[model samples]
Target: MKRLKTLASAVVAGTLALALAACGGNGATTETTDEGSSTAEAATGSTYKIGVLQLTEHAALDASNEGFVAALDDAGIDYEIDQQNAQNDQSACQTIASKLVNDGDDLILTIGTPAAQAVASATSDIPIIGTAITDFAESGLVADNEAPGGNVTGSSDLTPVADQIDLLQQLVPDAKTVGLLYCTAESNSEVQIAMAEEALDEAGIAHERYTVSSSNEIQQVVESMVGKVDAVYAPTDNTIAAGMATVSMVANENDLPVIVGCDTMVEDGGLASYSINYYDLGYKAGEMAVEILTEGADPAEMPIEYLAAEDCQLIANQATADEVGIDISGLEDAEIV
Candidate 1:
């Protein structure tokens, strides 16, 4: 474990923060009437000190942060945001979460489950809007999905695991056994894995788990399942998503069909998937933050938001298809990546 940063050194740590300021410039406007006194126009809106805690640097997580910022800007909320990335380090997440809480930010937006959990543990008084988290209840971030009894509530990137697995089966019909790949440390991935196990059981398909604790083990774990499982089903997991190049290289070399959970992963070199628009999910979370900051809405009463089935799209990678010898022509409405 890495050493954690103390709050006494917050300024030094703040300097280490990305310090991304997302707001319009020059809100000050001067207006003069018939009198000699000149009055300045009111500022566009309330300026807020916002803190963003992202788990890691990946396409999905990056999109979520961008979408959240876009929503805040569209709502006319002037905000100075401190962006901190854990870089998949647990100690870094804790250290940054503590600094953000100590910074006296008006609101905190966490992009991934680990980041949300760390910030939620740091302070409950500061309203937290989390995006890219799968199950709030399972993660202990909220009491219920409909009525979050606590301050933590936001959007859930809970992709349809069953439907995604079904896509894998459709792409590889003769595959007898499938391997579920993910990081065991992520609670969100655990929830999806359980659902996937149920889906596989219902379909009477044999399935096995290929779990890894960190990105360092992704290559070895994926390589272990080469011949044992005919197909691989990986969720929108952070660790696995970040190391997709390794996973694809190993799986593709063995002529294994790897089905991913998000469209961004397909672009990263997976076979096919039911894509979740993480940007829209983060935008939804940002709208919730707007309500809390400007509209005075309570996250405790806000229900967790999700993308409907109609919102999810089917996607496949033509390059991976040629490499793994799979046919995506049978999949309807699947956008080629």
Candidate 2:
């Protein structure tokens, strides 16, 4: 980890130097404004410089960012932000994480499992608050969720797997087999899968697991599962969330109902989900950051937090249900997206 951090620092330093050099000559000059102030006045007198590294572009991840920023604003916390999206590239995430560490931000906010992992690898001293991540221990982000013995602690978006499995069963009572789709590279996904498998086993439901290494293979792999399973179960898998349109296209063509891990996934054409509101989850993480930044709370001793069961929402796509010939009328309590 130390060697990797050293390499990341070198890469980011070179990249930042080239970036600065490219913008060196812009023919700009500073001048006094009508208010007797320099033209170089900042937008705000922010005392804090917060660095945000988002793993990829997707609805749930985007909501997490929105909520985090909104929370800071609501708290009247003055901050300068340097936010960057990795576009689902691990190397890009590493570069951004290293750059943030080198820039010496007051605190770092990482979205998604990979981004958190990248930031955790970059610095051990800088405080990190991660959102939209599941199973921090499984991802090796900390020694344990309770009493995380390191400079990391944040809210988890771990949907109750057994409850989600029960929802899957309720949605498709006749399903003899379910397809579990996720990214094989994500430890977060693996953690959820293990829990789901246990639930399926106890319920006597047969399931076939499928893995994808990247978004490029999602459509092909999903197409391959066409005739094999009655329905699909996708945990808050980032790769699948980024490629929901493709998954929807294939599943809809075959009239398969897909139960996902979050409300955004349902909005993106998934059949239904019993999951947490990612925006709320992110808000909680932002509050945690405030505690660390303002109250001088030690992240090394802060136990990881989670949303209550009542906080987990039931969201369903009514149009997808109609297209897939599933009866969601029984789920009247669920929020129709």
**TM-score, cand. 2:** 0.86
Off by over 4 Å in 2: 1-46
Q: Residue 257 of model 1: what lDDT?
A: 93
My TM-score estimates for the predictions, one after another, are 0.87, 0.86
* lDDT of every predicted structure (CA atoms): 0.79, 0.77
lDDT of 1 by residue, 212-313 (tens): 887888899998998899999998888889899999999998899999989889999999888779999989999999889877899999998888766888
Candidate 1: worst-modelled 10 consecutive residues by lDDT = 19-28
Tens-digit lDDT string for candidate 2 (71-150): 77666666677878887877777778888999998899988877888899899999999888776666678786777899
